[model samples]
Target chain A: MERERICFTLNNSPVEIHCHPGERLVDVLREQLDLTGTKEGCGQGECGACTVLLDGRAVNSCLVLIGQVAERSVLTIEGLAAGGKLDPLQTAFVTEGAVQCGYCTPGMIISAKALLMEKQNPTEAEIKEAIAGNLCRCTGYIKIIKAVQTAASARLEG
Target chain B: MQDQVVGSSPVKVDAKDKATGATKYPGDLRVPGMLYGKLLYSPSAHAKIIGIGLADAWQVPGVRAVLTANDVPGHNGHGVIIPHQPVMARDLVRSVNDVLVAVAAETMAAAEEALRKVKIELVELPAVFDATAAMAEGAPLVHPEGNILSHHKIRRGDMAEGWARAAAVVENTYRTQMVDHAFLQTEAALAEIDDGGILVLHVATQYPHWDRKELSRALGMPEDMIRVVGGSVGGAFGGREDMSLQVQAALLAMHTGRPVKIVCTREESFHAHSKRHAMVMHYRTGATGEGRLTAVEATIIGDTGAYASWGTNVLRKAAVHATGPYIVPNVKVDAYAVYTNNPFAGAMRGFGAAQPAVAYEGQMDEVARVLGLHPFAVRWQNAMTEGCITATGQVLESGVGLRATMEKAGSLVGWDVSKING
Candidate 1:
């Protein structure tokens, strides 16, 4: 395999790495960059556990090749919080008791961040629609929906 | 301090870590000079292994070590309750998930390449698929000990007495399908020698102490020699209660003298771990004209697959709970865990109790239909109260809140709990 160097802005910071063109972004993030926030529940991309924002749009990091992300800014769970302060969505998830096994939290928060970036005050149906791809076996999705709504309301108040 | 926390909602200890992606699951762990491990599984559910060729796999440049059944230094199997499941199948392969070979290499790519190079020869054998069919006299034996892994029964009161007092009866059979835990994080583990030269195993498992016992038995090492660090588990339900990637990774780590990490793909995760028992339950529930349950007789046949992972505990629990939360005077429950050539069933969300609910509850609905009583009314009538004895002879002494729950549910849906006097 031909080794290629890819450059991308991560969490508003520019970063570069040398990897194979077809290597999964999830692997590059976890194994190479040492950013373990993006979880890989299903490598097939069916499960949204490895979701990350590719230019502010949530995409399955496991499906996106490292080379495909060249010159684009990517956002992960680690990048959501700013200036050592907890993001509203992260605070909401913690307070709402939405993080159960915590394996799906990173992806869940990233997906929510992508939605709130576009829509400030998303309806419950809109929140549900955004997180439809993300599956949480715990909490029955009730507390999760509530958390998303709570975060959206926080954004509206701010 | 303990008393203060008892009645209050305590924030989960790991919730913050989980929300921030700070917890490191076994798959996310990284150590310098770590090798990746890969496993080769049997192609057929039931087969006789003719040969396993490791020559070509060992020839791979980045390959560290390729191990087969013969390389296992101690006992080959790794089951917790019954050590019948072979970590590496030698002569017989009872299930398709059975591991035939394990390879350790510098890169996961190399490990995958090595696994592709290793060849296995097998002759397919006749396999029984279900629990009931496997119990027949002429059925192919999944194990030499016979197809019945375990049989649990709760014989309470006389069957004649139970059948005689019945005003209305419901008899029907219920079948439950096999279910996977589908935990967000697939099975992953890293095995390496610490500074003290002891094996330290990092894994996402429900029970680390149990892992110690089984790993000791399989590795032929003392329990102290093995150290298991609990990785931040994503979601187990009941899937991580058994050994999956612990043994093979440890073996490779010990042999190659390197930190060996093995992370299963989604497909491999489905195969490597145990599943929930797919049960076949036949229920005959009898009740009086006033909706008081007289008796409940059930025969539960759980398809435990190839080996008895947690079959004994599962079937016994199923037998104990066959009558549900109702009060029945006379009850008989016979639950069997039978061996089949499908995926081995271990622990799940409900163990084995969930399957019988489909039957007993259906029977309750049918009994209510025949007696022309409201279903909730019938449930309220037969609900287990304080001081009531269970079918398994356990007396409900205190905190028997079945009726209290029904009262709240009754109010929620506008059911008149006080007005329903049968």
Candidate 2:
């Protein structure tokens, strides 16, 4: 097994790592860098529980190999908040009662953040389309859609 | 007093940590010198094990150990109510998902590679898939005790006289298929020998104490030599109630003197755990022209599959709730939990009530059509009120609010008055 050294920007920090080229990015992030926030729900790309921002686009980290992440910027759930203040999306989710069991919360928030970053005011259908990949069994999508709408409005007011 | 926190919405205690990806589940656990374990399952639904060859698997680089049923140092049986299911297949495998072998190695890839090297020889046996066919005289017996696991019955007033008073009758059969829980997180467990030589297991299970007892018995270790702990679960809709990887991981860890972790893939999770029972139900109901109920009869057959994992309780509940919430003076219900070589059936959200409710409610709709009465009107007329006796002979002292619930539902949906008159 050969280890290749690759440099990449992670959570606004530059880092270099030597690891297997075919290793899953989710494994590298969790096992090597201690970034266990990016979960691996299905280990396949079907479930979006391992969603991470790869150069401003949401991608399933489990499907991305370490070699593919070289020279790219990656963002995860840990990097969503700045200066100890919770992200508005995170707060809105709590206020709107969108989270239950909370296993899918991080991935859902990441997907929602990716949507909000691209569009200022997404329609209800657009919001639904954005999160169609992430599955939450408890909330039934009513409170989640409401929370996304609330976050978009709060962003506009701010 | 006005409720302060009872009705008010409060944020869940684990919401923040989970949102920030800080909460750790059992799958996220990792310990020093930990080995990954991979299990081999039976491919045939029913088979007799001839022998297992493990010399090639032992030769694989980084492979620590390969274990089979013979390696289980204690009692090999494990089940919620009945000690019938084997931890590993010894001589016979009644289901396709029965564990055959387990391999522990330094890495997951090594463990999987070693698993492919292990050879298993099995003689295929004639399998019985249908519940009714399984109970037939000539069908293959899933268990030596015959195919019928248990039967429940509920009888009320004279069925003949009640049917004689009815103006119309409706009879039909309904069937439901097995459903998987499909939770976000699959089954996962980590086992390690602690400082005091006690095997500590962290798993995603509904019952940690029961897991400890089962693992202790299977490993031939004293209860005090094992400690089971549960972490934050992702989602468990009664699917995590059964044992998955707890005992296997503990055995591997104890044999190799290192931590062992096993995480089931989504495909393995579907084959490994218990599922909701598939039911076939027959319902017959007699009602008057004025939409009053006279008699009700139901027969429910539940295919409990290979093992009796809470099947008897499910059959009992199905029999008790066969007549629905209506007040039927004359009723007879029969429910049977039959064994087959299909997937094992166990606990789910509604247990057994959901299946019979579909049948009884569907019969109500048919009865309404036969009497030319509105659906809501027929249900409202026959709905049980306070002090009405149930089919099981239990008197409802209070809290019989079916009529009120129907009225509210009808109002919310805006029932058409003109259609009812027509």
Q: Please give the lDDT score for candidate 1.
A: 0.90
- Model 2: residue A51 alpha-carbon error in angstroms: 1.4
- The residue ranges of model 1 lying beyond 4 angstroms of the native Cα positions read B1-3, B420-422
In DockQ terms, which candidate is top? Answer: 1
Estimate, for each residue in B24-141, the C-alpha lDDT of model 2 and write its tens digit: 8887888889899988888888999999899999999999989999999998878898968888989999996689898899998899999899898999999999887887898998
Cα lDDT of model 1 by residue, B300-361, tens digit: 99999998999989999999999999988898889999999999999999888898888888
Instruction: List the pairs of residues colliding in candidate 2.
Output: none
The docking quality of candidate 1, as DockQ, is 0.81
DockQ of each: 0.81, 0.71
* Candidate 1 clash pair list: none
Candidate 1, CAPRI quality class derived from DockQ: high
